[model samples]
Target: MRSRSRTYSLTFSIYSLILFNSLALHASEYLISYRYVVKDSALYNESLSISQAMKKCSGSPQIALELQTDGNKNLKKIISQNSEKFTEYIHKLGMHVEYKDTTNKAMNKSTTIMTLQTTCFTVDFNDNFAKIAPLK
Candidate 1:
């Protein structure tokens, strides 16, 4: 009876390991939108000393990252890598990203607006590095 019990425990442990491994292998998808502003040189005026600027996408995707778990180093690295990948994907898809530039002579300021839309593939730092695909 003791031997049989030991066998059962071992089997359960093996299955648990398999389950954990499977979960680790799974990936999550997310849709990300990022926006930023930049100075539009073309619209800038030297006489007025205007600083031209443009806005990119509105913001980033909603992904909560805890400081305690998602350290700055890992977060920065991942974000930089994702940006490169997203740019490449956009170019490959022939996506046109338009930035609107404007200048206000009276205000002595110029603005350029830009938007970034893409699906980011990510890996969970806490989930055994499971792959996360971009959201549709």
Candidate 2:
């Protein structure tokens, strides 16, 4: 009886390990959107198109995309790593994304916004989104 119990425990442990590995492997599908403003730019006087800015993503599928606090700045590539979550948010907003960043020299993305939803969302990068897997 003891030997049987040990075997059962070992099997359960193996399945748990597999589940954990799967979750980690796909974590990037989700990301927290980071928003901010850049008070240091030449375009201090002009109205920028939000859609046009995102459409200019530099060849990446795009992930976490948001207008900088001001129109002249943009946040790209940062969210591409977690495009899934980003896309989901935009979709939930009743919109589609992947805009252009036609401005010369882009804004630096250092911070990210917190996760928008407690459940799942798209990241808009690789056209995928998933829920934040619970940490072990």
Candidate 3:
């Protein structure tokens, strides 16, 4: 009886460990968000032009636009094929890359482990605060 109980306890412990590990693995998907402010209207326009060009070149209008990176196999495939061009576009954006924590609870929870590479970009402007409005 003692040996049978010990074996059962060991099996349960192993199963629990496996379940926990699986959960941790699934939690590894990260949603990285990029935010930048273009202070100059000319620069912002230029950035928009470059962004449109990037979309044309990549044949993916979603490129440089707001994208949901997690589980986006199509976007992943596009970026993998045009990594150099994508890097160039980001570089041409001419904004300093700054890492900041997301205040969103869902985003924070999803990114707890961060094993997968996911990214998002958002260009936000406050008309009342900014001297120039974004070009339509």
Candidate 4:
């Protein structure tokens, strides 16, 4: 009976560790700031912004003005395909990205920023919050 109890406790301890690590890996708080910058395109110099880039996105959320990438995939899929490119493009447009919740915005924030704990790509376009993991 003692040995069986010990085995049960060990199993419980392992399960707890896995649960904690899973929670720690994914962060549900993030902030996106809008900004504008000047860049020279093929013909003229113009000021561009993240809102503009979003317009160009071909998904539910746009990335440019009336321009779409011609894809049925969501923003998360696009990022997972090539996060480096997407990250670079957005970064160049004077956008700020944060992964922690330290401000009032985070408290009222609804976007979920998935970290290494979850899937490879996680993005929320609307004001959607993270779903609570079901207890087993």
Judged by TM-score, which candidate is best?
A: 1
Model 2 bad stretches (over 4 Å): 31-136
Q: Residue 71 of model 4: what lDDT?
A: 51
Tens-digit lDDT string for candidate 4 (19-133):
8776544432222332232222122222222111221122132232111223523433433455456445445434432233334744532232322211112233333322111
**What are the TM-scores, per candidate, against the unseen true structure?**
0.36, 0.26, 0.28, 0.26
**Candidate 2: deviation at residue 86, Å?**
13
Which model scores highest in lDDT? 1
- Writing each residue's lDDT as its tens digit, candidate 2 over 1-136 gives 9999999999999999998876654533333233323233322221211122211122323333442122221224433554566456555544322222333457542322222222222222232322222111
- Local accuracy of candidate 1 as per-residue lDDT tens digits, 18-133: 88765554323233445545564553321101111122223333433322223433443445545555445534533434555444665555455444554343335553222333
* Candidate scoring better on lDDT of 1 and 4: 1
**Regions more than 4 Å wrong, model 4:** 28-136
**Residue 21 displacement (Å), model 1:** 1.5
Residue 133 lDDT in candidate 2 = 25
Off by over 4 Å in 1: 27-33, 39-112, 122-136
Q: What is the descending lDDT order?
A: 1, 2, 3, 4
Worst 10 residues of 1 by lDDT: 46-55
lDDT of 3 by residue, 26-61 (tens): 332222322333332121212121121111111112
RMSD of each: 12.8, 15.7, 20.0, 17.3
Which ten residues in a row are the worst by lDDT in model 4?
A: 50-59
Error of 4 at 17 (Å): 0.5
Model 2 Cα shift for residue 89 (angstroms): 20
lDDT of 2: 0.37
